[model samples]
Each structure stands twice: as structure tokens, then as C-alpha cells.
Target: MKTLMKRLRAFALSGIIGVGLLGSFPALAAKTTLTVGAAATDVGTLDPHYATSTSDRTLVAWIYGALVRFAPGSTDPSTIEPDLAESWQVSNDKLIWTFKLRTGVQWQAGYGEVTADDVVYSLEKSRDPKRSAFSADFAAINKVEALGPHTVRITLSRRVPNLLGLVTNYAGGFIICKKAYEERKDRFGRAPVGFGPFQTQSIVAGQAVTLIANDKYFRGVPKIKTINYRFMSNNAARDLAFAAGELDASAGLANKSWLQRTTSIPGAVVDVFYPAELTLLHINITKPPFNDIRVREALAYAISTQKIAEYRGERFTRAPKSVIPSNNLGYTDNAGVFPYDPAKAKALLAQAGYAKGLTFTMLSSQLPEYETTAQLLQGQLEESGINVQLQPVEHTSWHQMIRKDLSPVVIYGAARFPVADIFLTQFYHSSSIVGTPGAVTNFSHCNVADKQIDEARTEADPAKQVALWQEAQRLIIQNVCAIPLTETSQVWVHNKKLNWGFDLKGSMSLGPLVTEQTSFSD
Candidate 1:
């Protein structure tokens, strides 16, 4: 009874919006509501730990606050700023990191203050493989302890100069209330509560998730009182709705047709963002056949960037000049590992005892871009005497199967900030091997330059670290662990009135964050 009273008092203090019905949004005539129609079929998961898609990340942002966050509208590693942790310090050895939290931050559903215990608990869960999919990233933390009610000390296993970025928004940094989660383990993913600017109101299957502004938010409650995040999977329907003014914003692919149609719509803006993501085909070295470097090289040589560029058709992105995008930090302009040469590919295959050509099935996601790229690759490989059968799996299942090492050749699409260490570690570190013990996303299972990667991350000197990171990428490209495909384009079509607070350079948020500044100008 005492515990219940405490909960009720805290709930009253939080100032959460009251709904007459459970799992239903309340009718509010005076509230400002924003309708967002996205290209996702559903809001994937509210649990920050399991979220892997843009839609999932968007929802997480609405209901959870990170320890640190990227500068508004930017995914650059250098722009990391404090969120939950007001200030932090690093010991001279650069191993011990201490963060001081702010007081009076209340968790949704009246769970109480955002204290050091919550941060420690959240980080602990992130490190536990049994609980989080991102355990590999958290494995870098040697130890974490709560110093006081609002202080946290973290000891790193390795000196990571950009440790702030690693723990920022996307790469597993959302702090959660421990008791609230423990009390609702079975419904955790479906219903997550965090000390964020907004609280979830309802999640209607196959439709939308509604959120209400947290009136007691530390940063001041969001001006937009309500948001309906609609899952509009049909591109045509989404576009039509945008024309009809049923949506404030909609997801867009970098294509000509979208431009031709959207340009004429009054009060609509099509914002194109770049260096968005890398598309790559992972070569599983531990698996048979591709385990041989020559076989991998042959496959790389079999890829034709020009052919792929032509096949993709849309101006969405360009064939990658290197594993890292042109603008990415530590991107060295060396000749790409493989030039398109069918003769060279054939020669390598012949030397590798695959002279008659080998056949393999490549697993691809059902997303248009993934499936399209897979088909184009199939054609390119066939031209080089390699026969590839394309198997299209639904998006979620495809991610699951690829991580299990189900396909030796897995076509993947991912985005990391311009930081090369992040890109290299997630895709090549020995510790991150998928389907292995405590695995995360090292689909290639390549350890060719692990030492260089580790050294780059630890080198406090910025210039030296960049050079080392460049060297690491060179080594991985040399090994043909994966073939760099293209960087996809990002386009967001939104109502002109919704002024995203920052300059529209790029967005990590599926739709850039909706803040008090994101108001309807009209």
C-alpha cells in the first residue's frame, strides 16, 4: 500500500495525459496534433534494445531520452551533446569516464526520477546478451557503477576517444526505468516508458501509434501536444495522402518519379540528404567456399558498379568509390579493391578451382532497394560465370536469418555516422560475428585488421587516429571481406510549415525530431 501510494504520487507529479480508455487515445479539441504517414508497414518495436529500423528508432526517440544525442539533423560523430548526462569527464588515462546526471527528471507512467541507478541498469542490460541485441557494443565497457544518486562512473576496456558518440542515440544509449520494465517483462517491447518529451498513448495494430506530450518534460513540453505515427506501407497511398493534406510528412525514396509528382504540390518540400547509408554484400569467410580469399576476390571482381548504377535507375545514390562514403572521415581515395573485370573474375575463379563457375543463393530483404540490388547483383555475377539464385525474405525475417549466418552471401544496408571506427567495428570486429556467441553484426566474420581498428579507436590524437582508421579500411578492402555497393539517398517530403529546427543536412531520425521548434509556420 505504501509502494502504491508512492507510485500514485509520482504519477501525479509527472503530469502524464489521462485517457478514459486503456490502449486508446483521448479526444482533445484544443491539442495540436501532427499526422505523420511513413512508408513502414508497422511500428516495429518500442523496446529501444530490439529496435533496428527507422520506424522503430523514430518511436524510441518519441518516448525515450538518450544519455547523449547527435546534434539536431546530423549523424556526425563529432556533434554528440549531452541529454540525460548533463556533463561528463574523462580520466587522464582516458579509461575512466564519469557522467553527472541532472535531477528532477521523471520517467513516463510516474516511475520516478531519471537517476544514476536507471543509467546503470540500462547499461547493464545493454551488456547482457540475454537481454539486448546490442551486447557486443556494450561489451566494450569494462565496468560501470553508480557513484551516487546522480553520478555514474564507467571504465572502458579500451580507450575509445569517441566514447560519447558510441553511447549516443542510435547505438544503444536510451536509459530506461528498471522497476517499470521488470514489472512488465512480457509486455516490455509493446509498451516502453522513458523520461522523454512524450509518452505513448496507444498502439493500434496495422494502423498507428499515438503519443501525448509530457507536460513535465525537462526541456519543456513539446509544442505539438499529440502525434499520430501512421504506418502507410503503400508508397502510392502515402503520396496520395500527402497530396490530400492528410499527412504532415511522408517517407520518400530518392527517385525521379517522386520528385516529378511532389514538386508541384503547394506547401510541400522534398529534402534530399546524403551520405545516408552504405549498401554492402558480406562475404562470410568462416563459411566454406567463400572462406578462400581468392573466391571472395573473384566475387568482388564479378561486381560491376556501372552496371549496378544503370540497373538501379533512380538517382537515389551512386556506386560507392570506396567502402566509406566520399564525405566520411578517414575515407582514403585509393583504387577500390576490385575493378569490374569479368576476365579477372573468371581467372581468379579458375585458380580457386571454381573454373566451371559456382552457384550460391544470396539472401536479400524484401524491401524494394534490397531486392532490386540483389537481382542486379545476380545478373552481374552471372556475367562472370557465377550463378546466384536470389531469395527474397521479408524484412524482419531477413535480418534474423542473415544474423544467424544462414546465407554465406548476405546483402545488407546500414548507416553509421561518418565515424569509421563504428563502421569497421560493427562489420569486421571479431567480437561482433553474427550467429556466434555474443554476436552482433560482424556478418563477414573478418578479423583482418582488428588490431589497427583497436589502435585507431584508442589513439587520443585525432590526426593519428584518422590515419589508422584509414589503414584499417584499406586492409579490410584488400581482404575482400565485403564489397562496397552504393550509398542510398534519403529524401523526406514534409509540409512546408513544419520547420525542422536545424539545417537540413541529414537526418538520423526517420523524420527529423519534432520539437517545439517544429511548428506549423502557417
Candidate 2:
């Protein structure tokens, strides 16, 4: 009996030792799997053309290819290196552009070779009034035609120097499978087919999305076979999952507490990329009380952007004085429009006939940074004798409320682009406000109309177009349609064991993510 008991103890101890060894190196014990967490509140349509939100663009980029891609170090936003297209040139007149497509690129759906016809078909579908997916962006294109199987020609209605930049934009320009669209036009947006480095394996909306390597990708198959995107409604949960070893990387690590907690763990790193977007308070100028320019100017001076930046720490940049940041192509230092003056704010309020002080609610979502900024602005405005209320709502509800023209003031952020043209055209252009959220422009409804903004749309000269855009910015700031607060940096948290390289300007292109530039350490 003693000998039998000894044998049983030995067996139990061996099993325990084996388990301990396995626990010591989790990476070695299992298949290499990477899980990324994102705080995506809404499920977007899969069709790249129809995707409107930034979160949806993040997913679409992985599934599609653009004709030209922005080179990593290129300072010119308008200059793009070839992707699906091997080479491209513009006519001396700068109105017509021709592209030579690469040979032997296959769509994911086993469709025949991607031809110029596919490019023409994709652009036409995007421009269809019935589609309404990305019509505003492509409205300037007069026509797109297939010169041949390998050559595609695009003619613009006007001289658009930044046409290539527009083509690289994630939402509207992704190449789709012509055959797949013809057969599944109704559901194509739900399940898109593209020729990208990564192919969609499966997606469970608002839960997780899985992507597998595209073996037949033209650039080359991605080294990583699988990429799993897990959705978390907020940063707190995402940070917890990363610390617990369930997630490898996450975006929107804006919370300081979460960053502090995660960085404390071994093998974890925090990367602070340049401000991809800016957060600001938007006032509805189309409505009453706010219609008065004095009231708008008063509100701009009443809030302290510096305080908001200080509270947020290094993650936030000081609110830019101009609508476009200095880093943008046509950014000009225009401080005259935005000056921090409490007394001036008070006087403006009185001038606007609110000597007793104006009271209004500031709407924001559950984002901690936004909520904190709103609270700080509330305090600052109160100090300036303006009564302000901070109204916090769910993200989805907030989006809905803003679209209905119900919110007087709301806190919002928009991702930056290479050119100021994209900013002015999308947000301030009259046509853009019709169907979109208008958050980029914040539906500020400024009266300082610009025919130049319209003329620049068809204008193709780079220098001339930039001059027009600068004028638009000048007008926008002069009118004080929306208060520019701060340019907020994109904070990404990841395990140091994984390697990834992303541009300072956040790009929807997945080349950086797929090229093994982003990898994991053993």
C-alpha cells in the first residue's frame, strides 16, 4: 500500500510540473494568434463604397486595394506611388490621367483578372445617384473609361490637382470585384470581394472580425495567416483584455489610467502617433441664438482649450487656431480669429443681447476624454458668465440626435487628411451636408459663402487649388463657424512582443499592417 501511494504521488507531481512549464511561456505552448481590440460602437456596411464611419473604414481597408497609395515618407499628399496600377501619368493640361494596371491580379472571388473595365465599373457604381455611397467625393470626375484591358483613363470635370489623393481615400476608391457585384449587387456591400493582402474569413458584427492571408495577393501573401479583430465598447474593457493576455494590440488608448495600468506589465509598449484627429465643440449656426456671430465668437473665447489639453496629458495637442492644422497642406497661422479672451467673450455675449448670460447644454458621448473636456469647458464658460450644461449620452444616441438638428452644441473629433481641400470640401462644401452626418463640418451653417470653394472643386492646378483652399480657411475662421479646440493624437497600445509601424498621419491602407513591418517578437 505504501509503494502504491508513492507511485500515485509521483504521477500527480509530474503532471503539475508539466502544467507549470507550459504556463511559463504561453506563446510557445499554443499556436501564434494575434487579437486586436477596437472600441467600435456601430456595425458598418461591408461594401467599401457605402462605409461612412472611421470604424468601418478601418475594416474596409483590409479587404480592398487602391489604385495609388501614399508613400510613407512623401510630403506631397497629392503624389501617390502605384499599387494596383504599375504607373500613371497626367496630361500636361492636368485634366486627363491615364494608369497602367499590373498584369495578373486576381480578385478574391476567383473572378477573371482585374481589368480596366473593373476600375471603370467600380467608379461608375460609386458615382451613381441611386448609390449615394461616395457620390460627393467622386462628383468631380467627369468620366472614367477603359482604354484597354490594362489601361484605364480618368477625366476630371475640372483641374483637380489632388485627384490622386482623393483616389487613395479609403471610403470611395477601393477596387471591388466586378463579377461578384453583378451577381450579388444587393448583398455586395455586406460581403465584398477585393484583391488585398488580407481576405475576409468571417465577421460577427459588433463582436469580432477575422481575416486570413490572401495567398494570391499581388504584393505577396501576408506572413501572418490570421488577424482577429475583437470589439470592445470602451477602452477600459480593451485594456483589461490586453493585460490579461487575451489581446495583442488596441487602438483608442486615450484613457491615462488605462495606459498607466497596461504599461506597468512586462512586454507592453505604448506608441503615441501624431494627432490623426481633433476634438472640438460644434455650435449649430443654422439655429437661433447661435446664428448671431457675436454669440459664436463669445463661445469660442469662453472655453479654455489649454486647460483641456493639460488635463488630457501628452495624448492631446493644443487646439489649432485655424480650421486645418499647420501640418496640413494649406495651413496658415491665423490667430486673429481665435484669441482666449474672457472679457471679450462677456462683451460679445452682451452685444448679442445676453447680458444676463446665455445658458445652453453641451452634448457629448461616453468617451472619457470628451466628457472631461466638456466638463472643463463648462467650468470655463461659467467663469465667463455663460451658463453651460454637460449632457452625456450613448454614442449611437448622440449620433442620432446630432443628425436630427436637435443638439445646439456637441463635442466631436474628425480624422485629419493630407490636403486641406478634403477638409473644406467634405465639411464646408454645401453638397456634403445633404446626406452625411455633417459632423466634419458640424453643420455650423456659416453664411460666409465661397464660390471659390465651388470653383476649386473643378480647378486642377495644385498651386491655384491651394490658394483657393487657403481662402476658404480664412473665411471659415473669420466667420467662426466652429471653434477649433485641439488636435488629438492617436494612442495605440500593444504588447512589445509584437512589432508594427504606422504613419504619423493615420492611413486606412493596410500595407504597413501586412508587410511584416508590423510583426511579433518570439
Candidate 3:
């Protein structure tokens, strides 16, 4: 009887243990879903061509496919590799570029074949001022012609050494379908047509955007069936969502403390990348007080970048001495010209005839970093006898004010690119000056500086062009065009279980995140 009882107990225990093991196996092997959160201030417009803000760019990247995409491991973020375009060659003079399109690539909708004509149309429409695309980064293209079903030719007015780099940029050369764009012009931005691994499922402006797997994508469909991009208004809220497991990933992380706090969690991982964005103080040169170069220089010298970096946590920040970060190509250290000197600042203020000290409104957004920097500047300037009134504004309003050149001083962030042209051209070009209610350039209205910038733009030789850029930088520094502050590092927080190897750079590149090489593990 004892032997029989022992045998029965052993059998029951073994069965129970087996069942427990089976239950835990799934827990260990379950597939992970990554939810990325973005601190979006406003809802993005459905039109990819119309997107101007960084928030819109984040969403557009998933839905749209470019002719050539920036390779993940390239030293230069703007260097191009084959995407829709299999290969490309530039003429000896570098004026003309011929691109050979990849074969067997189809649109997500399977809406007929994608030909070179589609590329031509997309470029043409983007450059068309009538279309009013705020994102016309490729307006410099002289012309685009479809050579054949699989080939396209681009002619430039002037030789662009960084032509290929520009083409791979987020704003310049995203390819779209001609048929779909024409048919769904109104809905295309929300429901974009692309050759990416994912297709747009839905977009609710200012709220969330969703993408689903494109089974027919030439590179093969993404393993993840769906991607949801949720818009949280601020980093604090976004971080909270991530900690709660409501989000898998968060882009443009603004809070270092929160990120550090979350990394302690078992499934959390903090990914730090070199930020492509520079946090700077933009002085309105068109305005009265700031128009004086002396005043601008004084203001620039008043703020201490070293202190700002220290206070903000130096691990994710670096004091930037030039408009372009040191990591970028063609960047030269120009710190000597814009050295911090409180005594010199005060002297300049007196020389500018503001001996009684100057008081002006300094504008910044509600985000913690901007607000903190603004306050820090305020204190620093006050010591130099300059009273800076802190004006904290909403993100949308702040953008508008900066574009209109309404504020005396404004805190701004710019994502750095491989080529210096991207920064110098857009910000300093006279033609790019925003004049109306919603101008993109913030109406700096700098005509004299514009002429010098134009000369640099047309210069073809890389060495010559760089010399010109250096000259331009010196000129801007002399005029105190804008106070270059610091380069803000990009920090990404993710769930450790989802393994998508990505390096932190100045800007976020989505290509690697969606590539086949990216895989998840429990």
C-alpha cells in the first residue's frame, strides 16, 4: 500500500512540474512588441511634402521611402546607399546625376509598377512653389528627368559636392507614387504611399499614427506586424508611459533623470546616441536691439555654455563652438572667436550705447531643457547688467514667434547634418527669410549675410567651399548672428527584451530599426 501511494504521488508531482515548466516556457519565448513614444506638440499634417517640423519627419520616415537611404554605419549621416535606386553616378563635372532604379520593387498597395516617372514627379512637385511644400529642401535642383522606366537624370544649376548626401536626407529626396499621390492628394499625407517595409494604417493628427507590415515590400516585410507612434505632449509624460510599459520606445528623450530612473527596471534599456541637434540661442538680427552686432556679441558672451552643460548633465551634452558639431564633416573649431568673457560682454554692451544695461524678452519653450537653459541664461546675463525677461511659450507659438522674428532672443534646436550647407543655406539664405505670418526662416531678414552665404553656396570646389563656409562662420560670429550654445545628445529609452541595435547619433535614422538585422528576444 505504501509503495502504491508513493508511486501515485510521484506521478502527480511530475505532471504538475511539467505543466509549470510548459507555462513558463511561453513567458520566456513570447515575441515582443515595441511601442515608441514621441513628445509631439501638435498633430502632423497628412501631407508628407508639407511637413516641416521634426515630429512630422519621424512619422513620415516610416510611411515614405527615399530613392537612396542613408546607410546605418556611415560616418556621415547624410551619405547615401541603395534603396529604391540601386546605383547612381555623377557626371565628371558633377552637374548631372544618373540613377538606376532597383528592379522588382513595388508599391505597398500593389497599385501597378513604380517607374522613374514617379521620382521625377515627386521632385518636381516638391520644388514647385505653387504646391507650397514647406519641406522643399531640394529646391536647388535645376531639373529632374525620367530617362526610362528604371532610370532618372538630375541636373543641378551648380556643382554640389554633397549632392548624394543631400539626396539621402529626410526632407530632400523621399520618393512617392505618382498615381497614388494624384488620386489621393488630400488623403495622401495621412495615408501615404511608399515602398517601405510598412504601410500606413491610420493617422490621427496630434494623437497617434499607426503602420502595418507591407508584405510586398521589396526588402521583405518587417517581422513586427504593426507599429504605433503615440504622441505625448512632453517628455515627462512620455517617460511615464514608457515606464508603465505603455510604450516600447521613446524618441527625442528630454529628461535624463527620468531615463536613469527607468533603466533600473528589468526590461528597460537606455540607448544614448550622438545628437545631430544643436541647442542654440538665436538672436533676431532684424530686430532693433539685436540688430547691433555689439549687442549680439555681448549677449553671446554673457551666457556660459560650460555651466549649462554641467547643470544639464554633461554625459548627454557638449558645448558647441560652431554651428556644426565637431563630429560633422567640414566642422572647424571656432571657439576662440566666440569665447565667453563676462567683462568683454559688459564692455560690448557699453560700446553699443547700452551702458544703463539692456532689458529684453528671451523666449523659450515649456520643455524642461529649454526652460532650464533660458533661466540659466537669464541669471548669467543679469550678472553682466543685462536683464533678460524669461518668456516661456507653448511649442507651437514659440515656433511661430521664431519664424516671424518677433522675439528679441529665442532658444532653438537644429538637427545637424553631414554637410554644412544644410545649416548655412537654410538659416542664413536671404530668400529663405520668412516674411509672412508663418515664414520658415523666422524672418531673420539678413540681406548682407545672405549675399556672403550665396557666394559660398555657388562655390563648387570642396576646399574652396569649406574656406568660404569658414569665412561665413567668422562673419556670422563677428556679427553675432546666433549664439551657438551646445550640442544636445539624443537618448533613447527602450525595453531590453526588444533588441534593435541602434547607435545614438545627432539625428535619428529609422532605416536600421526596421531592417532584417533587427530582432527581438525574450
TM-score of every candidate relative to the true structure: 0.87, 0.86, 0.87
Summed over model 3, clashes come to 12
Worst 10 residues of 3 by lDDT: 503-512
* lDDT, residue 211, model 1: 90
Total residue pair clashes for candidate 1:
0
Q: Residue by residue across 1-522, what tens digits does model 2's lDDT show?
A: 999999999999999998889867645533345688766664456787766554566677777887877654233465468888998999987889999999999898577688898899988877775664556667778999999999999998776547786666355677788889889988776677888867777778668888777778887766566888887867678777888889887765455566667679888877665434666566777777888889989988887777766656655455566776666776666635577889999999999899999998766776555666677778888988888877777665665566555677767776545567666665566655533532324366554535767766666566887777778887777777778777766666777777554443445431124432345666
* Prediction 3 global C-alpha lDDT: 0.69
Mark the regions of model 1 whose C-alpha exceeds 4 Å error after superposition.
1-31, 306-316, 325-328, 350-357
TM-score of 3: 0.87
> Where is the poorest 10-residue window by lDDT in model 1?
14-23
Q: Which stretches of candidate 2 lie over 4 Å from their true place?
A: 1-32, 72-79, 128-133, 255-258, 361-363, 367-372, 385-393, 396-404, 435-442, 447-449, 455-467, 501-518
Give Cα distance to truth, residue 180, candidate 2, Å.
Answer: 2.7
Candidate 3 lDDT over 271-382, as tens digits, reads: 6665346776766787888888889889888888877776666667777787655665556787345777899999999999999899987667765557767787888889
lDDT of 3 at 449: 53
